[model samples]
Every structure is written in C-alpha cells, then in structure tokens.
Target: MNVLHLDTSALGTYSISRQLTAAIVGQLQRDGVASSVSYRDLAAEPLPHWLPNPDPASDNALRDEAVLQQFVDADIVVLGAPMYNFTITTQLKSWLDRVLVAGRTFRYGPNGPEGLAGGKRVIIASSRGGKYSGGPAAAMDFQEPYLRTVLGFIGITDIEFVRAEGVAMGDEAKQAALQAAHATIGELALRKAA
Candidate 1:
C-alpha cells in the first residue's frame, strides 16, 4: 500500500508534529502495511496559492497535477499539521486547494455535495502550543475543526488524530503531551490490525 506523508511545520527538527508523523509512518512500515511511502515537506516546498483561474501551462499547474495525483493514489495519508495562530499553514491549505477538486474529490449532486475520496485512512499529527481542547481558548480553535470539516467534505471519514497540545506551556507539558500522542499512535496500530 502507498502511504503519503505530508509535513507542514516550518520548525523542521524542533517540530513535534513532524516527529509524531515520522513515528506513525515508521509504525506503518514496521507493521508491513505500507509497501511504499511518499514524503512531502510542504513548508520547504510550498505549492503556490492556487489561482481561481489557473494557467494550464504554468509551473503551478504541473505541480498541482502531481500533488492531486499523489493524494488520489495514496492508500493512506499522514499529515503533520501544527496549529499556526489558530488554523492550518498556508502551504497545507494550498495543497488542499489542488486536491479538493470538484469532479475529483467531491461532486455536487441534486441533493447536495457528495465526496468521492473515501475508503482511505487519514491520520493527522496535530501539534498546538496551547490547550485548546478545553478552556476559553477551545472556542477559538479553528485548526482541528476546520481540518475535520474539510476532510469530511472530501469523504474521508476514516480519520484519526494524534494531538500534542500545550507544548509551549513548559518542558514537562511538552513531554507529557508527546507521550500521549505516541500512545494514541500505538492504539491506532491496534485498530488497523482489527
């Protein structure tokens, strides 16, 4: 099976989301599930913001085709999405614009919208600087909710999230959150086995 791993954190080595995504991909590899893995660091190789009317011959068009193809072809998708200010990174959003095509990922039926990109499992390694799962900041969290809505819109309902929150609180908090995320990843493996 093909695993598409996308990392969007700008911090590189210091990014907890990146670490978690790597571990998740490693676990998949060790489980003998992923026959091949494709890695894309969106932060380093950012796709240009998609234009409403794109030039078919432009470089961005070629890149968009390749990006969309990767998403459509992958059996599994792992995303390292660190909350930037409250939502996803612009780079990741740009990538989404390419993949969430009208006749590709979704379609507008007579009743409403229907998603075409189902059956694939998606795991998101989400990292946040503060505690947004609860507290007053919870209402302000647009990252996870937005991702869930958008991915669901594309028919990706078999989704899992490994979150490392309150990382910026302190060293202890960071470690604890990371440990929790790792535990979640382990549980995901068990679920996959079942």
Candidate 2:
C-alpha cells in the first residue's frame, strides 16, 4: 500500500504532531501495511496558497498537480496538523488547497455536490497547546472539525485522529498527553493494518 505522510509543523523536532505522525508512519512500515511511503513537510517546503485570482497556467499549477497526484495515489494519508490560533496551521491549509480540486477530488452533480476521491483512509496527528476537546474551548476548536468537513467533502469518510492536547499546560500534562496519543497510535495503526 502507498502511504502519504505530510508534516506541517514549524516546530520541527519539538512538534508533538510531528512526533506522533512519525511514530504512526513507522508503525505502518513495520506492520507491512505500507509498501511505499512519500513524505512532505509543508512548513519546510510550503505550497503557494491559491489566491482568488490565480493564473491558471502558472508554475504553481505544476506543483499543485504533483501534490494532487500524491493524494490520489496514496491508499493511506497521514498528516501532522498542529493547532495554531485554535485552528489548523496555514501550511496545512495551503496543502489542502492544492488537493481539493474541482472534478478531481469533488464535483458538482446535477442534484448537488459529489465527491470522487473516496475509499482512502486518513489519519491525523493533532497537537494542541490547551484542552479544546471539551469545556468552553470546544466551541472554538476549528482544527479537527474543519478537517473533517473538508475531507468528507472529498468523500473520505474513514478518518482517525491521534490527539495530544494540553501540552502547554506543563511538562507533566505534555507527557501524559503524548503518552496517551502514543497508546492510541499503537491501537489505531494496528487496527488499520488489519
């Protein structure tokens, strides 16, 4: 199977999302679920955000096509999505803009919208500085919700998330969150392989 791994954290080695995504990818490789893997670090090499008025034949189209091809070829997609300002990072958004193409990932049918890119599994490693899963902050969480909406729009319904929240609370909280995420990855990655 082909796996596409995308890292969008600017924190590099200090990024919890990156750490979790790495472990998940490693687990997939070790379990023999991923025969080939393609890695892309959005923060390190970001794609240009498509503006409202973009040149159709611009050089960015080539790059966008390549990114779209990667998404189309992968059976599994792993993303490192670190929360920034209670939402997803700009780097990840840019990558999403590249992949969500008309008539490719989705299309407008006579009745309504129809998604073309179905049957692919998506796993996200999400990291947040504070607790956003519940309480008042839950309403402010645009990270996972937005991702789910966009991915589902493209007909990708099989999605899983490994989350590490409350990392900025303290070292103890960070460790606990990381540990929990790791345990989740262990179970999820194995289950996915099966």
Candidate 3:
C-alpha cells in the first residue's frame, strides 16, 4: 500500500507537526502493510500557487495530475501542517489547489457533491501556536476545517487528525503539546494493529 506523507511546516527542524507525522508513518510501517510513503515538503519545495506554463514544479506539475495521482494511487495519506496566524500555510494551500480537480476526483452529482475516490484514509498532523483546540478560538481555526473540506471534496472523506496546539505559548506549553502528540501517535499505532 502507498502512503503519501505531505509535510507543510515552515520551520524545518523545529516543527512539532513534522515530528508527529514521522512517528505516525513509522507506526504505519511497523504494521507490515507493504507500505510505501511519498513525502511532500511544501516550504522546501512549494507547490505553485499559480502555474508557470502548467509546469509541475518539483515534480508536482503545479496541477492536479501528479498530486491527485499521489492520493488516487495511495491507500493512505498523512498531512503534516502547522498553523500560521490561525490558518494553514500558503504552500499547503497551493498543493490543495493542484489536487482538487473538478472532474477527476469529484463530480456534479444529482444530489449536489460526492466523493469519487473512496477507501483511502487521511491523517492530518496539525500544530498551532496557541491553545485553540475546542477553545473559543477553535472556530477561528481554518487549517483543519479547510483541509477537511478540500480533501473531502476530492473523494477522501475518511480522515483522522492529530493536532499539537499551544506550542508558542512557552516551553511548558510546547512540551505539553509534544506529549499529547506522542500519546495520539501511540493510539494510532495501536489502531494500526487492529
């Protein structure tokens, strides 16, 4: 099975989300599902927000073909994202723009909208600087909600999220968030066994 790991952390080495995603991927690999992972780092190799001659930059094509193909071709997808000012990174958004094709991944159904590509699971590893999960600021979190909509639109409805919030408050908050992230990863690891 193919697992696509998309990491969008602006801070390369200091991103808690990226660390959690790595843990998740490692756990998935231990399950012995014949898994293969595709890594996409948006900051280092950003997806084109607007294509320059429809070129697929960094092998992404700045279009849906390669990006959607990654999901359409994979059994699972793991997104590592960091909240920037209450929203996700622009680089990740660019990647989404490439994958949410109108006809290929979705269609104009009689009901309204329906996901075409089913059976794949997506796990989002998100990090926020402040205490926002289920808080009054939670509604302001456009990262997770927006990702849910965009990925859901293109036939990927089954999703699980591992969020690390309150990282920027202080060292204590960051440590707490990291601990929570690890706990979530362990649970996912157990789930993989089941």
Candidate 4:
C-alpha cells in the first residue's frame, strides 16, 4: 500500500497527533501490508503554499501538476493535525491548498462538478485540548468536518477519524482519550482498513 502521511502539528515529536499517527501506521505495518511512505512534516519541511512563480510568464499550472500527481498515486492518506483556535492548524490548510488544485483533484464538467481521484482512503489523527466529541460543540469542530468536505470533493469519500481529545484537561482525561483513540485504531486502522 502506498501511504501518504501529512503530519502538520507544529509540536513535532511531542505532538499527540503525531504519536497516534505513528501508532496507526505501525499497526498497519504489523498487520503485514508492505506500505510505502510519503511523509510531509510541516514543521520540518513544510509544503509550499503554491504561489505563482516570480517570472511573469511562469505558469502555476506546471508546478502544481507535479504535486497533484503524487496525490493521484497514493492508496491511503494519513493526516496528523492539532486543533488551533477551535479549528485546524495553518500548516494543514497550507498543504491542502497545494494539493486540491482545480482540474487535478476535481474539475467542472459540462453536466456538473466532477472529481478525479478515486479508490483511496483517508485517515485523520487529531488532538484537541478540550472536549468537542459530542453535543452542540461537536458541530463547531472545523477540523474533521472541513477535512471531510475538501477530501470528499476530490472523490475521497472513505474516511476514518481517530481523535485524542481532552488531553490537556489532566492525566486522567489524557489517558482515557488516548486509550479510546488506541481502541479505535485497533478496530479500524488496520493494514487493509475498511
């Protein structure tokens, strides 16, 4: 399986989202699938926001075409995110802005809008400071829902979310959330994830 992992949490090694993504990736490998990794560590080597090149005649299309090709070939995609200001971090959004190019991930047909990529699954590992798992606040969660909408616009409809929330509350809350995330990983984040 070709796995494209986009780890955007600025906390880097200390990030809970990164840890969960690692554990999930480890689980997949342990389950015996030969996985190829494409890692994008936003803090280390961030994906460019994809502004037009300096030369007036230089086309953005050529530059973005190369990156979109990478998206088309991956079988599974993993995104590691940390909540910021009740939403996703800027790093994650920056990467999305690069890959979700028009005519690459999606295009407008004569009939209607059409997506190009297919047959790939997306896994999002998120870490939040407080509780937004359920209730009215859940609807306010901009991270997962935004990701779902954008990726789905490119025809990536199969998505699974594993969150480690309330980690900042205390040791007890952190442990409980981590355990729950791990359990979800065990149940769903397998080699051949369904």
Candidate 5:
C-alpha cells in the first residue's frame, strides 16, 4: 500500500502526535502493510497559505497540483495532527486546501456536493494538551470533528484516530495517554494484519 505520512507539529521531538505517527507508520512498515511511504513534514516545510487564484504556471500552483495528486495516489494517509487553540495547525489546513479542489476531489452534483475521491483510509494521530474527548470540554473540541467533516466531504469514511489527550496535564497523565495510544496502535496493526 502507498502510505502518505504527514507531520504538522512544530514541537519537533517534543511532539506527542509526532511520536504516535512515527510509531504507527513504523508498525505498518514492520507488519508489511505499507509497500511504500511518502513522508512530509509540514511544520518544517510548510506550504504557502492558500490563495483564491494564482497563475496556472506558477511554481506554487504546480506544487499544489502535485500535492493533490499525491493525495489521490495514496491508498492510506497518516496525519500527525496536534490541536492548537482547539483546532488544527495552519500547515495542515494549507495542505487540505490544495486537496479539496473542485472537480478533482469533489464536485457539485444535481443533488448536492459529490466526492470524486474515495476508498482510501485515513489514520490521524491526534494530540491535545488537555482532555477534550468528554466532559464539558468536549463542546470546545473543533479539531477531530473538523477533520472528520472535511475528510468525509471528500468521501473518506474510513477514518481512525489514535488520540493522546491530556498530555500537558502532568507527567503521569502524559505517560498514561501515550501508553493507551500505543496500545491502540498495536491493536490497529493486528487488525490490519488480519
């Protein structure tokens, strides 16, 4: 399988989402599920903010098309998405803008909007500073829900999130979250292998 692995964390080695994504991709590689992997560190080399229109032959336009093509060619996509201010990073959003193009990934149909791209799996390594999965903070969580909405809009219904929440709560909480996420990754690999 072709795996597109994207990391959008500015924290580098200190990012929990980055660690989870690396471990998840590594597991996929070791389990022989991934035939090839394409890695893009968006934090390190971020795409320019999306514009309404650009010259067709411009370098940025060409790069955007390439990014969209990569997404189309991949069988699976792995995203290291850390919640910033209760949402995704700017870098990840920029990448999304390129792929969610009209007549490419989706189009307006007689009924409504229809997705042209389908049948791909998306795995998100979601990290948050505090617990947002439940309790009062759940309403404030715009990260995972936003991701689900946009990806689903493009017809990707097969999505999974290996979440490491409450990482900044304390050392113990961070460790526990990581342990749980790792356990989930193991289970994911086993399921894929099956």
Candidate 6:
C-alpha cells in the first residue's frame, strides 16, 4: 500500500503529533502494510496560501495540481495535525485547499455536493495542548471535528484519529497521552494484520 505521510507541526522534534505520526507509520511498515511511503514536511516546506488564478498553466496552478495528484494517488494518508488556537495549522489548511478541488475531489451533483475521492484511509495524529475530547472544553474543539467534516466532504469516510491530548497539562499527562497514542497505533497495526 502507498502511504502519504504529512507533518504540519512547527515544533519539529518537540512535536507530539509528529512523534505519533512517525510511530504510526513505523508500525505500518513493520506490519508489512505499507509498501511505499511518501513523506512531506509542511512546516519546513509550506504550500502557498491559495488564490484565484485564471491561468491554468501558471506555476501556482501547476503546484496545486501536483499536490492534489499526490492525495489522489495515495492509498492511505497519515497526517500530523497539531492543534493551534483550537484549530489546524495554516500549512495544513493550505494543503487541503489544493486537494479539495471542484470535480476532482468533490463535485456538485443533482442531490447536492458529491465526493469523488473515496476508498482511501486517513490516519490523523491529533495532538492538543489540553483535554478537549470531553467535558467543558469539548465545545471549544474545532480541530478534530473540522478535519472530519472536510475529509468526509471529500468522500473519505474511513478515518481514524490517534489523539495525544492534554500534553501541555503536565509531564505526567504528556507521558500518559503518548503511551495511549502508541498503544492505539499498535492496535491499529494488529487489526490491519488480521
């Protein structure tokens, strides 16, 4: 299987989401599930913020199409999504803008909008500073829900989140969250093997 691994964290080595995504991809490789892996560090080489361009042959349009083709060709996508101010990073959003194209990833049909890109699995390594999965902070969580909505809009229903939340709460909480995320990755590998 072809795996497209994308890291959008500006934290680099200190990023929890980056660590989780690396572990997840490693697990997939060890389980013999990934035949090839394509890695992209969005933080290091960010895509430009999209704008309307009438020229299809423009450099920006070409770059956008290339990014979209990568998404289209992948069998599985492993994304490192670090929550920033309760939402995804600007780098990731730029990447999404390239892929969520009209008649390419989705289209307007008789019954409304229809997603053309389907059958690929998306694994998101979601890292948050505080607990947002439940309780009072759940309402403030725009990260995971926004990701699900956009990805689902593109017909990717098979999505899984390996979350490592509350990392900034304390050292103990960070360790616990990492451990849990690692365990989830292992479980996913076992299930894929089965």
Each model's lDDT comes to: 0.92, 0.92, 0.81, 0.80, 0.94, 0.94
Quote the positional error of residue 86 for candidate 2 in Å: 0.9
Once all C-alphas are superposed, what RMSD does model 1 give against the true structure? Answer: 1.2
After superposing candidate 3 on the true structure, give the runs of residues whose Cα lies further than 4 Å from its correct spot: 52-64
Error of 1 at 45 (Å): 0.7
> Candidate 5 on 44-96: residue-level lDDT in tens?
99998998655889888888888999999999999999999999999999999
Worst 10-residue lDDT window, candidate 4: 56-65
Weakest ten-residue segment in model 5 by summed lDDT: 52-61
What TM-score does candidate 2 reach? 0.95
Quote each prediction's TM-score: 0.96, 0.95, 0.90, 0.88, 0.98, 0.98
- Across 29-132, the per-residue lDDT of candidate 3 in tens digits comes to 88775368888788898876756445545454534476667767888888898888778888888877766666777788999877777788888898998877
Q: Per-prediction RMSD in angstroms? A: 1.2, 1.6, 2.6, 2.6, 0.8, 0.8
Of the two candidates 3 and 6, the one with more favorable lDDT, higher being better, is 6
Q: Pick the winner on lDDT between candidates 1 and 4.
A: 1
For residues 76-176, what per-residue lDDT tens digits would candidate 1 score against the true structure? 99999899989998888988999899999999999899999999899999999999987799898999999989999999998889999999999999999
Question: Mind giving the per-residue lDDT tens digits that candidate 4 earns over 86-191?
Answer: 8888888877787776787889999787767767988889899898978878977888788888888888898999989999999999999999999889987443
Per-residue lDDT of 10 in model 5: 94
Superposed Cα deviation of residue 47, candidate 3 (Å): 1.4
Per-residue lDDT value at 64 in model 6: 82
Which 10 consecutive residues of model 6 have the lowest summed lDDT? 59-68
Candidate 4 RMSD computed on C-alpha atoms after optimal superposition onto the true structure: 2.6
